[model samples]
Target: MTNHAAGSIPDAANTLVSENGYYGAYGGSFIPEILVPAFAEISRHFEEIRHDGDFWQRYCALLANYSGRPTPLTYADRLTAHFDRAKIYIKREDLNHTGAHKLNNALGQALLAKRMGKTRIIAETGAGQHGVATATVAAKLGLSATIYMGREDMERQYANVFWMKRLGAEVVGVDYGSQTLKDAINETLRDWVSSFETTHYVLGTASGAHPFPAIVAFFQSIIGVETKDQILQAAGRLPDRVYACVGGGSNALGVFQAFFPHDEVGLVGVEAGGQGRDSSNHAARIAYGEGKPGVAQGYRTMFLQNSDGQMKDTYSIAAGLDYVGVSPILADLSEKGRVRFAAATDAEVVEALQLVMKTEGLIPALESTHAFAGAFQDIAESSKSDIFIINMSGRGDKDIFNIAEGLQDEEWKGFIKRKNSQFEDQSR
Candidate 1:
């Protein structure tokens, strides 16, 4: 593949994977024969439309008018003062219409599905942000929508589940395997295998099969694109480092890809370190786990696997970060030392969340809090003149229940119980 430097627009032939979809031995299509046609169709249309100016015009217009574009790049003055090292800025993706960066990809893919004449949309979500985003777009477009979520995630993120249902989506809870994001992905793929004719599967992150990683990254690149421009305007130069939390790596790849060709800009991806890396509770596949390449979820990448090559279960206080495998593009980049990987434990993430709220007056999602924690660690030894930008991938509204529980907010729990009792009484 052709290599494009930073500050240039990346075309399919340059920035993305090869024609066969291998990103330096990491990414490829490894699906069954039955799914070949669907993947090929998506690949063909995406290749055609991605280069079309009209397609981008429409996509950008929708982003600006409907979903909110050019999200703010706010200077966290208090955070910088607290750190007393790096001057910190945050790309406020949390302020988007659906409260996260997921809507960017969701809206783009939904528009593509419309172009393809697909009438239904299916997606799998962990923290339910993607599901809510997908459902919101489907409702706006007057298309039928179905969301597959793990049973455990549905319970933990019940507020998002409620919003998705209210938006007119059929929510299916997968109970197989660990009954989490991985299982939800497996179920969504099975559904796509049979329904690929009239349905479009909106894969949540920058993982999965060939076109998906590329496609999702293409949509998400808007984040990095905006950040680069905004940071230049705000700080008069590129940041010394950019940090983002990586689950399936959509947000990280979104921000990192724009800075990939910039060797001076440090790219740091923070993974979920659960309880700790010493224990098996972390999802730091590229950081602490076996970095062996293997095929799972229709792509080859580094995964948390056991001796028998079975994918191991992962844990994180943030449901979105609890994944066994990461984005293949990120894996390849990490291996090549183009990007750095770090992990923040659950405790550190919670502390970071509180710190951001107290200092910046921004309630960041738990997933984004990992990036905050990682940035704190990295900036501690750096000079005060150093500049860092954190991609605040989502707001903390969806995570209020989880955060309250994590921080042991008994008053919040009592309020929730009171509300639940009121609803129960109304139902009775």
Candidate 2:
């Protein structure tokens, strides 16, 4: 462990094995025979190329020229003042070219695909940010892109559907169990099994079979590196806490990796409380589930599934946060109490969405609203007066359709009442 002026913990770079993976009993490749060779080839090349100076320089050039890297860190002055002079700053990943933090990892993976001479790219998405990012990069790199999206999500997030089409990606609608992220993933896994020789599966977040979670985390850690330097330069010190939302836990891991060295700096992860945990709807896997190791879409992690290997139905207004299984690294961290996991109800997320828009003039992705809900509440209760940094993971444009759909629903009142009761039950 390295010590800084701020309190310190283990360095992330040192936490990994020589093979580039982690999660003590949680993460590894559990794929079928056909895809195993492809994964092994990709993993071997990735370890070599990651250290190539020329490769990274080209990657940096693309990030600067195309995706606009070194995203700004903005101070939320109005909101900060409201919380008793505690400085609240946001890492503005929402302003990235594709309008979400997903672009950072997509660009990195796409570059790797180009080097591997892969001619086609396949990906799975929930709220569609990853699909849009993949589609954007595939169009730029002149590669064919296929995105598998759940049938339910395809209908709900139609604007993003149009965005993918405009980018020239073929969007395959998955109509399996529940027609959601898990089903979309199942479809993508099937595609990988059939076409691993000619295609690359660009996993969206930092959670998947062996090399993927580690590789994605390495790429996204740029967020934390830049944020650390930027915050120190701006505030003349490190933040007292950092907050981010977890889907498959990529963005959260990205931002958290930087501050992990600073043990005094709290790392908080927020999950979608959805309707509520008690309502059999929320996606707070760490907080409410019996959480056992299981494989879903090829990665072993804590799953909200049954003994017979059937997944439980999960609900969240933010589709990105509705995965039935979380990254094993996160599950391990939570189990060890190295990090704190909290849930934000849909009502709390809505309130947070409204708060940032009204005070900071920023409408964040609905998934990110969960982080704001937790951070704001933590600030309200903490006695320590220090700076806080939160990852503004994505912009809210895709959620306008969700908000509009909610407006037209006749069950809105009843839905809210049931959600409120669920929240009350969990809180009590």
Best by lDDT: 1
Cα lDDT over the full model 1: 0.89
lDDT of 2 by residue, 1-428 (tens): 11121222223633753343557777777778878799988898777766666766676668777887778889999888667656899999898888998987888888888888899999999999999999999999999999999999888787888999999999999987888888888888888888878788899887788888877877777778778888988899999888999879889988888887688888889988888777788888886655567877777888887779888888898999988888777777777677798889888888788888888899899998889998987886665468888899999999986764544555765786799999999999
Clash counts for all predictions = 0, 1
Q: What is the C-alpha lDDT of each candidate?
A: 0.89, 0.82
What TM-score does prediction 2 earn?
A: 0.90
Please write out the lDDT profile of model 1 over residues 198-283, one tens digit for every residue. Answer: 99999999899998998899888888888888888888999999999999999998888778778999999999999897898888
Error of 2 at 112 (Å): 0.7
Worst 10 residues of 1 by lDDT: 1-10
TM-score, cand. 1 vs. native: 0.96
TM-scores for all predictions: 0.96, 0.90
